[model samples]
Target: MATKSLKAKGNELAESNKQLDILNGGIFAEGELPFFKDKINEIGHFPLRPKKLEILQINVGYMCNQVCEHCHVDAGPDRKEIMTRETMAQCIEIIRNTGAHTLDLTGGAPEMNPDFRWFVEEAAKAGIKDFIVRSNLTIIRANKKYYDLPDFFKKHNVHVISSMPHYTRGKTDKQRGDGVFDKSIKALQELNARGYGMPDSSLRLDLVYNPSGAYLPGDQMALEADFKKALKEDFDIQFHNLFAITNLPIARFLDYLIASENYEDYMYSLVEAYNPAAVENVMCTNTISISWDGWIYDCDFNQMLDLKVASKVKHIKDYNEDLLNDRNIIISQHCYGCTAGAGSSCQGTVA
Candidate 1:
């Protein structure tokens, strides 16, 4: 959790990125917003860098079943971008050669990718210790073909982390879409029937709790208790753990914040809640994000912002372990989300 002072040069670059403004839906220009950089200056350490990478988190595609209001990926059923088998082969090679123990797969709905199963099978054979699948829940119940996903995930021992904004249908459906909560519950039940989330089962099923509005998430353990109690008492659902994720200011969520006139307040909240201890364990330090087109990024939020890694090996095809390891991560104001409060990442709070 140690950090050097936020140098003048680093602050200048982080707050001056024109690309960041464009990527953030043009709500406000970088440096124009005074929250993130000012807070970092107070805390010391403006632009963060990578540590020894141990996780390869890849976004396989942009096609999703539901277009949620808060979806940072902006994924929808009409989106056609997906990772091909060729790209999967290259990614698998990188995972193998880089000695990354975890292969994290995500997407509009990762299962919606045609080569998802193929990639998982290949990575599993390559000795990946942990395979994390970020699912949208409804996709598993969206079609007959996807119905077998729970069993397939169980077979590969893939850790299932799905988005469930709230335990109540009102809050869940409000953020996602109508009927989403019902479908998600159905899917969770299906997963439970197959040993996932069960105490004695090796299969793990974790639920993600995204803030329903432009706000930071609550305590992870406390929220998990709330979700477990509500779901179990209301619908008899069960899960292993809960990940409380702070919604990054980007994409659809960014647009929502601006529209609702809460953008500045939310950014201030993130800056004020800054936790330096969380910086050391930020997902980017240990994880490398791969976009569907094979581009490399520091994290999924960075990927969404088109903040390509500062490394020369910025694509999966190139896959340079040393250059990536030595390079500084591309940072912007959006990084506040990852360093705020307990700090948000793909695995929930870092602190």
Candidate 2:
């Protein structure tokens, strides 16, 4: 794992505005690729607006155990930002009444938050149909205190969506960190022992496979098949599904693209694979992303870029879904990532 986040290293890319400048100033400024708004406008979809809310994707903190090279959150042990119980209380209040059906909890590793369990236990009571906890897997083995995480999740029926990167140890460890593969395998087994990912269980245990590098993921079903075969044969591990997500160019990923001189080519790839149908179901249209400090955004990507919602309601403390639903979704070059190919969202492909 990287010893420090770009923010801790004082890398300019840590600044959302700096990253936005690069995203907005590059080949985009020279018309090498159409600006995201123009691309959307070609289909009469400019000024992207929200639809009926369906998911509440909340970032409880940025503190995480690993520093994956492609991490858009730039989360790591070095990150100190965390959500306080007070902010979480506000979230629970909204959760108890929101019309949204899915409640997604994310972070550097949301488990790192001091009040993570308290928040989960409270939110679970809201009776949301799909309760998700985006776990990093290794965190379940990082410390003894976390050993019971699988049991806790099973008790609450929290849908465990873990980041596996690849089915092979080499690719998995390379993208996340050394020893991550072994630990993740163990964690998956433990989750299995608790009935997660088991074919006969209702406990949903899904693995997320984002490309280890600057490339779009292949077919989700094919990748899921390969992962199932490799994992079941190699480790007797089982997961219900695999979500193949496109790596949006932002945060550490954008840094990698720029440092490796693949930014332009990657942008070209995204533009070439742009699927107009994908734009209609982008996460921004149905989800509201809340930051660690309670600020609201159109989506997690926009949250990282510090793009607050274009509405009167701007924070969780002041959440007004009706007003929030009536706003334009922000767009920029990075928007291409979510609209490319089959289209990527938190729930995997849309088209």
Candidate 3:
């Protein structure tokens, strides 16, 4: 009976996805992050100071199995863009020269890239202190080739950060497509078996949560407890940590806001909750995002909006730490998502 229900739900989702593709014209469109806009206007123009670049996040490709409703990357299986070996080589050279402590790999599914493992293996050889793979979870179980990713990550001691939109199947499926929740859970259990979430285990597996609707996420610590309890009770899964991320208003999510008529209300919420302290620790101050094509941006959200870094060095081949640090962060309404409440960043709450 459960199997039948799951199959029926999957079929329904397939039909919904087809309709979404039509509504989006096969390409995700931009929507408003009202709060970001209001904050930008109120704060006026302030120059961003470059602290030492500690983490370099590289986008390997835009190919993904599922097109979620709130995706900021607007990535899908149809996306043909993938990073070339030449660009990867350039990034490696930058890593060698820059002495950045961490390398964060992200994508529609970073594992989908042919060079994904190669990049990880090579980067591991570089002796970087931390390696992180931002996975969508479902990809680990979606293909035979990727099934061994947990072991691969274990071999490299890679810190795995994966998305699981909600603890409940209903909400998670609604946001990420049907069967995603089940696959994600199975993948998590596999990671746990390899000592990912266990105490004293070197393998770290963290789950990422973003609200399915237009509202901001509740308290991070509190939400983590709920997730930990739910996943443990229902699926016998364990993870090292839970990161609550606010969905930035850009890309597919922005399109949802415009389509659902929630754009103004969502923006107002962000602006109203703005805390000045959040601005000081915004992730862009400490991190830089590299697109699949090798263009640099202040952060990943900025990258999707085609907002290039304000620095003279805009690409990896000619990465200039001094110039990038001296440049101002490109400001827009979308930024409010990062600065609201306790603040949110790729690594979770900034404040």
Candidate 4:
């Protein structure tokens, strides 16, 4: 088991190295790929800007338990970047001042943050309308100490959004790690026992799905049906909703695309499937992504690419709602990923 795990880690490192090469090689340079602005302009919406700051997506850290093949964050257990209490305090202040309805907490595993529970407890006290935790599922069952997470989540009413690559163990384990499938199942059952996803229960649990390869995800409703049926019959698990997310071309997935000779094809696919309508409701329009160190970006993908918001005020300490409200979004060819097909965001399809 250790040998297989080591081999997987080696492969992950190799892909990450390849992705760094491609990113450093100027994959975002003009003419290297289709300009996102051109496509939007052709449709008569040239420069995209923020609509309203409805969701503040805070990336608390990059320390994770597993290294998935398609992770855009390139996060793992080895990552040292974790959000400090000072920075999180600044974020909470912004949330209070801005009255942002939803606090979307994300990370390598947001729960893995040493101060995660404290943050949640305080944030709830601040009266934020909704608390969304983007979990990896397996983390809850990763250790004996984490076993109480379900009850903890219930106590705080934290809406759990987990990533389940596929309903089947084979595809899921392939994309995630070797034994991830079994762990995820146990974790889901635990969540179910806690009234999460139960009919008429206020505690909501949603699962997110992203294609394991370069292709876009299938229809959200259809895929959700399949996931619901399979999980219920096979494991007797219950969940509220399934969100189908399109994999953006970046990080390990970018490396996979280039290594498999699918880089250009995948980029073009995003550009080709551009939905003009999807642009109006893209998550970036209402969401602001904050890195662990407090720098701001239009979305999580932009954060990974080191693309800050176009506004002069770029950090949480200097967060200016007036400046950010009307500021033009910083975008590139990668923007196509969010606008393609049914559209993709942390919430799921836009159009």
Q: Which numbered prediction scores highest in TM-score against the true structure?
A: 2
Ranking by lDDT: 2, 4, 1, 3
User: Model 1, stretches more than 4 Å misplaced?
Assistant: 1-19, 22-47
Where does candidate 1 have its weakest 10-residue lDDT segment?
1-10
**Clash number for every model?**
1, 0, 5, 0
Residue ranges of candidate 2 with Cα displaced over 4 Å: none
Tell me the lDDT of model 2 at 276.
100
Give the per-residue lDDT of model 4 (tens digit) for 4-27: 221235654335344444543454
How well does each candidate superpose onto the true structure, as a TM-score? 0.90, 0.99, 0.88, 0.92
lDDT of all predictions: 0.81, 0.93, 0.80, 0.84
lDDT of 1 at 155: 87
Root mean square deviation (Cα) for candidate 2: 0.7
- How accurate locally is residue 229 in candidate 3, as Cα lDDT from 0 to 100? 92
- Better model by lDDT: candidate 3 vs candidate 4: 4
Q: Give the per-residue lDDT digits (tens) of candidate 1, residues 1-351.
A: 001111112422123243366434332345545545555566564566677788889899988888777777767776677999999999888877776788889988999998899999888888788889999999999999999999899888899999999988898888888889999999999999999998767888999999989888989999999999999999888899999999887766776777789988887787778888887788888998899999999888888777888878888777888888887777777887899989899889999
